[model samples]
Each structure stands twice: as structure tokens, then as C-alpha cells.
Target chain A: MRVSELVQRSGASLATIKYYLREGLLMPGEATSATQASYGEEHLRRLALIRALTDVVGLSVQKAAEVIQLIEGPGDDLFLTLGAAIGALPPYVESSNEQAQDYPLARTALERLGQVYDPDYPAVGQLDRALTAASAAGFPVDDDRLELYGAHVRAIAEYDIDHVPEGPAQGAIEYAVLGTALYEPVIAALRRLSHQDLAMRRFVPDSATDPAGS
Target chain B: MRVSELVQRSGASLATIKYYLREGLLMPGEATSATQASYGEEHLRRLALIRALTDVVGLSVQKAAEVIQLIEGPGDDLFLTLGAAIGALPPYVESSNEQAQDYPLARTALERLGQVYDPDYPAVGQLDRALTAASAAGFPVDDDRLELYGAHVRAIAEYDIDHVPEGPAQGAIEYAVLGTALYEPVIAALRRLSHQDLAMRRFVPDSATDPAGS
Candidate 1:
């Protein structure tokens, strides 16, 4: 298909498609004429992935490009590629968690959850940042609660990794990285919906109640 | 403090702070003289709130302003305010979920989770978007898995709202809004870390395994 059709179908403006092409995030198509080129299903998929990273996952274009490179270039160690892909995510709340500092609550939460204290992982820093922020906001997640949350999330993560298609390295890499970016809002939205249910049950007295559902 | 001090304290550029003042997102400081003014702690809090909304929540400046307005002006109904605040988050993967989406899987997931299938809530749209995207990506979240994930997230949400810092309406409003934005990264990070743990166990043969952790 032509660029115009790609833009129309993808719901992205022509300029956005052009900008992505220029940024090399979207690969160039077959040169059909002097200024015309053709795209395929792969282009559509790439566009969707790019949008998911930049718009949904909230990674900047540069970071998204790095993630794409990691996807396109899965090293000998797939585990290392996975780590790098996640590390490319936006560093939320640039605090001292980046440095090797004492985050006792984070440590407690991790130990209770049965997760190893691997300080080298970017996620440890993120966990530290989150725990610190929540604590600072007067809502310290106790060890038990943090452990419980971890169990549920670990199950979800397991389900996600289990579903990675048994195919080429590139396909699996795309699945892991894109799934990380895309499924987050799903998890978050469900969580928010759950919050709504709780609030509705507690505050909105007139609302219908379903204890069996919970 | 003065403008320079405000900039230094908040870590926002002078131009960015001035822009916020121009946009009326931040209230004007007390004018002490012709070309100078003084800010206070309230300004600092508001600045933090704005940064969370724009930087973390990925809300555009205009949308961030709207969220700020919602927080600033919580009507008599706290429930409604909560809805509006969550509604203000970025709509991930805009597809046909916005309308009365007849997503059978979504309906099943919601019903199994015992959540009310309200078409009006923005979160319903978000849930629909996430589920649909996941399914399209060939990782369909079946009803059983969705219900389990929902249960875990429900507990987290309950913990969050329970810790709403019982105080002024504005304070509570800020807590809810900021909590939504700030804590999402934390949740995502934790989930990712869990994924890392799972991947380490499954893929990396030499990696240490901790079954008791899960």
C-alpha cells in the first residue's frame, strides 16, 4: 500500500508517518516510482509497535528507537537483551535509588516477596523509587501487602512470558518488549476499575453491591 | 522565595516556571515589587503535582491543566471527582473500545471479576483497549487469568485508597491524582522485576533459583 493509505489506516497523520520514516523507526518501503513506495503488513505492525512504545508506554522516541534496536538485534544472551529492553524504559522518578543506597522498605518488601536482592537490575531501583514515593506520601506498603502484590504480579508476568510465541528470535523479542509496553495500561486500567469498585462499594451507598464478585 | 530560588528549589527552569505561571496552572505569587515576586510551599506542592501529571502520567500540558483544575475544584461528590481524575489518564490504544464495545472477552473478564460493566466509565474503555490489544498481539487474557489479575490489583487499589490521608478535600484530591500517576510506574516496575525473576529461572540455566520466593 501507499503512504497515504498507511496513514489513513494507521490513524496517524501523513507528517507523522514521514517523521517516523525519517527517524528510521519505520523502515523504508520498496521504491515503486520517483516518490512513491509500497508498505506491507510488517510496516503496519512496526507502526503499531512504535505507537505503543511512544504513546502508551510513554517512552520518548530515542528510547523507543533503542528498544527497537534491542528487539531487532537480540544478542546471543536473550536474557541480557530482555534486561536492556526494559532498562530502555523511562527512568521514573530520578531519585537516589539509582545509587547503591539503603532502601530498607524495598529490601523488606523484596525479601518478603521471595525475590532475590539483585541490586544491579534497573527494576530494583524502580521498586525502590516506588516504595520511597509511596512511603513519603504516607502509605508505606507493609511487607505482607507488598509480598501479596508481588505474588499476583509474578503470576501475570509468568502468564505473559509463557505466551511469548515459539518462533524466531525477533518475534519473541518483539513480543516481550511490546507486551511490556502494551499490557501495562491493561493492568493499570483493571486496577483502576477495581479501585472504582471499592470506592463505589464504600462511599456510594446507593450503588449496587456484589460481595460474591470480589 | 524569589524566582531564582523557586527555580532552584523546584528544579524547574526559569522559562518553564514562567510558562506555568503564564498558563495559570500555578497561581501567581505575591508581588513584592515591580519585577519580582515571592512563592511559598503551596507553589512547591503544585509544581510537584504538575510535574507528576505531565512527566509521569504522560498528560499533555493542556490535559495536565485540566487534571489540575479537577484536583483544585473537587465538587461535593468525592466519588465523581475520583471518576473524573482517573478519566483524565491517557487513553491507551484508541480503537473501537470508546463506543459501546461488544467485546465478549472483556464482558466475560469483567463479569468473572464481578465488576459492573458500565459503558460510561473511562476505565472500561481502557480495560477494553488493553484486553483487545493483548488479544490482537496473540496474548489473549482469558477469563480465569483476568479475574486472578483483577483480584490482586483490587487489593493494591484498596490499599491505596485506604491511605488517602484523611484531611482537606484538596489534599485528598491531590493524593488520589498524584497517587494514580506516581504509583503506576512503581507497579509497572514491580511487575517487570517479577518478569525478570521468572525469566531468570526459566531461561538462564545457571541462574540461582528461589522457589520459596514465589
Candidate 2:
């Protein structure tokens, strides 16, 4: 595919694609002739991931480039690539302070889940940021609720791990990363709807009486 | 309590508290004297919610104000208030086209979950955005995976709905909204950590054999 096809297919503006190329966030396509280059499926995949990182995951270009770098270089090394991905988590999800107060709740939460309480862990840092922020907002997550939620998510995560694409490392990595990035909104939406469904059941009695609703 | 006390208690700065007041997000404090007005517990709670909205949930100040509007005015009406909060969801979390093409996966996913497939539903819109983005990135969510995730999230949602604080409608609204906003990061972190734990179990040989890890 040509650069134009890349632009059209990826739904990204030409200038945006050009910007990614200039920034080295994207690998350049094969040069066919003067001012013309051909992109392959790999380029398209790369472009899609880039757009998701910036547009969906909301990582800065610098951070997205780092992630792209790690993804391209590290094949089948999930932890090593994801370690860099964790670096992008807090800033990508929310603009939190790096030097924020220590997250005692996050550490304890991890430890209780039978995992080592590693502060350097990305999710741990993210958990700390979230717990600290929630506490700041005067809506602290209690230990019991955290434990229950932990158990529930552990089930979900096991399913996710079980289903990660096998064979190709790149495919598996893409699935894990994209699934992590994209499915979050899906999970959040499903969770919200589940809440809404229950709320309707509990509060909206009329829904139960309605023949179609049940 | 005085403004200083509100700041001390709420962890928001004076300028921020003033901004919320100026924006009418917080109810005005009683006029204690010429030089000072006294705030109360309600103000502290209101401020806490506001900070969570802007800082943690990453809503714009305008969106945050609108949420505070919905929360304060529409007590006991979870659907009505959250309907407005739904208005804030896409822009708050991920920037996606509200006018983007139709979302079949989202609708089907909802219908499969025994919920009304209302396009107007906020989570539907969010789910649509996520699915569409995923598909465009060449990782379209299949029906089986969507249903599997739907089933998984249903369990978590029930627990969350069950845990909605009893008593004041305002308090209930606060919990639902804050829990929706705050616990997302927690859930994401937990899901990620669970995947890590599993990945360690399957791939890391030393962890199983190591006495401390088990």
C-alpha cells in the first residue's frame, strides 16, 4: 500500500502520518520512487497502534515513541516491553505527580493479592496514584472493597491471560497491549451498564413490571 | 468552618476553592462576617468531588462544574444525574467521535447482556467508541470475546451496585459517581497485576520453585 492508502486506511490525516514519520514514532515505508513510498501491513499495524496510543491511550508523542521503540525491539519479552508500557501508564491515564506521597494502600493491596509489594511495578504505581487521588477526594477505597474487587479482577485477568494469542510474539504483544488499552473502556462501560442494570432493578420497579423489560 | 479549615480538610488550595465558588459548583458559604464567610461539611464534600472530577477523572473545569451541577441538584435520581454525567464520559476518558459511525458490537454486546440497546446510553456510546477504535486498529472485538467480557463485567458490576452506600441520596450519588470515576484506575491496575501474576506463574520458572514467591 502507498502512503495515501496508509492515510485513508488508518483514518489519520496525511500530515499526522508525516508527523509520526518525522518523529520516528513510525518506521518509514519502502521507498518506491521519488516522493513515493510503499507501506506494508506492518506499517498499517504500527500506525494503528500509534494512533491508539496518542488518540485513545492519550500518551504524549515522546511517550508513545518510547512505547513504539520498546514494542518493535522486544519480541516475546512481555515483561520487558510492558515494563516500559508501565512507565507510560500514570501519565497516560491521568497526569499524576511522580513524587507523590508513598502509596501504602497500593503496596498492601498488592501484597494481599499474593504478589510481591514492588513499588517499581507499573500497575502498583498506577494503583498508588489512584488510591492516593481517591483518598484526596475523600473517597478512600477500603481494604475489604479492594480485596473483593481484586478477587473479581483476578478472574477476569486469568481469562485474559489464557486467551492471549499464542505462537507469534508480536501478535501476542499487540493483543495484550491493545486489549489492555482498548478493553479498558469496554470493561468500564460494561461495569457501568451492569451498575445501571442493577440500579434499574433496585430503584426502577416499573422496569420489572414491564413485560418487555424482563 | 473557615476557608482555611476547608482547605486544610479538603486538600484543595484556596484559589481552587474560590474558583469552584465563583463557578457555582459549590454552594456559597454562610456570611459569618464582613471579612469572612464560613463553610460547612457539605462544602468540603463538594470540593472533594470536584477535585476528583478534574484532577483524577480528568474532566475539564467546565465538565466538572456541570457534573457538580447534576450531583447537587438531582438527589436520589441516579439515572437522571448520571445521564448528565454520561454526557461527560467520552471527553473525560478518551477523545473519540460522538458522531463516529454506528457501533454494532456495542449494541449487540448490550442486548446480549439483557440490557436495552439504547444508543443514547452513555456507556453504549463509550463501548461503541472503544470497539470502533479497536476494529480500526485491526483488532476488532469478536462476539464471543464481547460476550465473555460482558459476562465477566456483570459479576463485578453486581458487587459494585451492591456496595452503593445506603442512606442519603446525595451520598449515594457521590459514591456511584466517584466510584465510577475512581475505581476505574483501580480495576485497570488490578487487571494488569493479575495478568502479571499469571504471566509470572506460566512463564517465569524460578517464581514457582522459589519459596518466598509461593
Candidate 3:
């Protein structure tokens, strides 16, 4: 397949395909001539993954490159590969240099979380960054709230892992990465829907009976 | 206080404060002269909220303005205000126009969710968009997965609404908005940490018993 065919099949612009090639996110096709290169099924697959990461998962090019590297690198250890993929995600909450004072509160929250999970896990830093940002914004999350949120999330994680298909290492790793990346928004959107449901229950419980009047 | 003092008090850059002012996100100060004006405590508060929305909640400047308008507009209807705040959030999952074919599957999942919640809710649209994007990326979420994710999220939302403080309408609305915004990343981070824990348990159960080596 040519680059144009890659574009047609992947629904990515020609320039985007070229950009991924330049950035080493997409491997170059086999050279057929000075001006032409032939792509293969592997190229199409890689391009799809790249689009999924960048477009759907919303990773930066640099972070997407890290994911690509993990996919292409040596060991087939599922644990290590999954770890690297999770680590490559850019933090959803960023800590600010000006708000160093908020770190102590965030650290306290992280310490409580560490008691239940790995203290040095990459998610710890990500959680700390989120707590720090929230605290700096004057919306500090206390220990109880953190624990409550953690408990529910742990349940979700159990379901997530329980469903991973028994298969090859690469398949498991791909499932972990793509599942985590893509399903995040699903969870978030569900949360929002739940919020509306709860809000209605709280604010307009009688409206259920009234039907048309209020 | 002057613009400089507003900057000092809000911890926002003078340029940023001015930009917010120019963009109508922040109201203009009272004019004392042709070139000079004085801001008040209201300005300071609004600036803080704007910063929290943009910096912590990651809302765009446009979305933040919608939040500001909701806060400043007439009526203390907590339900309406909270709804507006949630509605103003830009969709976390965006589907491309080219991927219209994927929407039907997403809409089907959303229809099942609608059986339990409001089908017309903005969050339904958000969830649909996310599902569509994932399906287009070849990561279609099954009905079982959607149900599993929704159940956990419903539990989280129960905790969220239960914890809303007893206060005036405006205060409760503020708490709801800020809590929802700030805790999103916390929930996401916890999910990731749980994933790591579950992965280790599933993939390396022997590591726990062996301690030293396998």
C-alpha cells in the first residue's frame, strides 16, 4: 500500500501519516523507488494504533512515541509492558511550580493511598499531582473522600482485570493499554450521568410524582 | 484594589487577569479615571474561580466563561446552576465527523443506559461520543463492560452527592461544581493504581509467596 492508500484506509490525512513517519511513531515503508515507498499490513496496523493513541486517547506526540517504543521494544513481559504503557500516559492533573505549598497536603493523601496500594507506583505520583492541583485551587480532597473514591475505583479495576482474555503476552498488553486508554472516558461519562441522576433525586424527588407540574 | 493588587491577590499574572477582563470572563473594575480603575473582593473571587476552572478543571477559556455567567446570573437555583456547570464542560471524548458510522453502536450502548437515566442529558451525549471514538479505534465496549463501568460509577456518584454540604444554594452549587471538577483526576488516578495492583495479582501471584525469587 502507498501512503495515499494508508491515508484512505486509516482515515488519517496524508500530512498526518507523514508526520507520524517523521516522528518515528509510524515506521517507514519499504522503499520501492526514489519517490515511492510501499507500506504493508503492519504499517496499517501501526497507523491505526497511532491514531487511537493520539486521537482517541489524547496523548501528546512525545507520549505517543513512548507508547510506540514500548510496543516495539524487546521483552514480551506483560507486566513490564503494561507498566510502561501506563507510565507513558501524561498526567491528567499537573502540579504547578508556584504552588509548592500544596504538596504537603497532597503527600498526606498519597500516604493514605499508599497504605492500600504500591507507594511508588506511577499512579501515586499522578494522584499526588491531582490532589496538589485541587488543593492549590482551594478544593482540597480529604482522607475520607480519597478512600471512598479509591474503594469504588478498586472495584472497577477488579472488573477490568477479570475480563482480560487469556491469550498471548502481546494481546494482554494491548488489551491493558487500549482498554485503559479508551475506557477512561467511558467511566468519566458514566460518572457524569450518575451525577445528573443523583442531582435529580436530591433536588426534585417530588417531581417524580407530579409528572407535568412542579 | 487596583489591577496590580488583583494580580497579587488572585496569584494570576497581570497579563492573564487583563486578558480575562478583556475576554469578559471577569467583569471590569469601577472607573476612577480614564486610565485607572479599582477592583473589589468580587473580582478577586471571580478570578480565583476562573483559575480553578481553567488551571485545575482544565476547562477552556470559553467554557470557563459559561461557568462564570452561571455563577453571576440571577436566581439561586442550585439545580439549574449545577446543571449548567456540568453542561458547560467540553466533552472529554470527541468523535470525528468522518467516523459517523461508529456512532450507531455507541448510540445503542447509550440507549441501554438511557433506560436507567435521562436519555436527553448532556452527559449521555458525552458518553456516546466517547463510545463512538473507542469503537472507531477498534476498541468497541460491549454491553456487559458498559454495565460494569456504570455500576461502579453509580456507587461513586452516590458517595459524591451524599457528601454535599448543607448550606445556601449558592454555596452548595459551588461545592458541587468544584468537587466534581477537582475529584475527576483523583478518581482516574486511583483507577490506574488499582489496575497495577490487580495486574500484579493476576500475572504474578507467585511473587507474593516467593518474596525473594521465583
Q: Best TM-score goes to which candidate?
A: 2
Residue A199 of model 3, lDDT score:
74
Worst 10 residues of 3 chain B by lDDT: B205-214
At residue A130, candidate 1 shows an lDDT of: 69
User: How does the DockQ of candidate 2 come out?
Assistant: 0.49
Q: Mind giving the per-residue lDDT tens digits that candidate 2 earns over B46-141?
A: 777776676556667898777777766776567878766766754233336544535566666666667643355567667766776677677787
lDDT of 1 by residue, B1-214 (tens): 9989989988789999999999989999999999999999888777866775675456789888888788778887765786777777866434454354555555667777777535556677667767765665455677666766787788788877787778688778777776776778778888888877777777764454644223
What is the Å distance of residue A40 in model 3 from its true position? 5.6
Candidate 3 or 2, higher DockQ = 2
- Compared with the true structure, what per-residue lDDT tens digits does model 1 show for residues A73-161? 78876667877787787555454543545555556677677665355566666677666655544445666567666777887888787
Model 1, residue pairs in steric clash: A114-B213
Off by over 4 Å in 3: A30-48, A74-88, A92-103, A113-121, A165-168, A201-214, B1-11, B27-48, B74-84, B87-103, B113-120, B165-168, B200-214
Q: Over 4 Å off in model 2, which ranges?
A: A75-77, A91-101, A205-214, B1-11, B39-45, B75-77, B91-101, B205-214
User: Candidate 1 chain B: minimum summed lDDT over ten consecutive residues — where?
Assistant: B205-214
- Clash pairs (backbone) in predicted model 3: none
- Give the worst 10-residue stretch by lDDT in candidate 2 chain B: B90-99
lDDT of each: 0.73, 0.73, 0.71
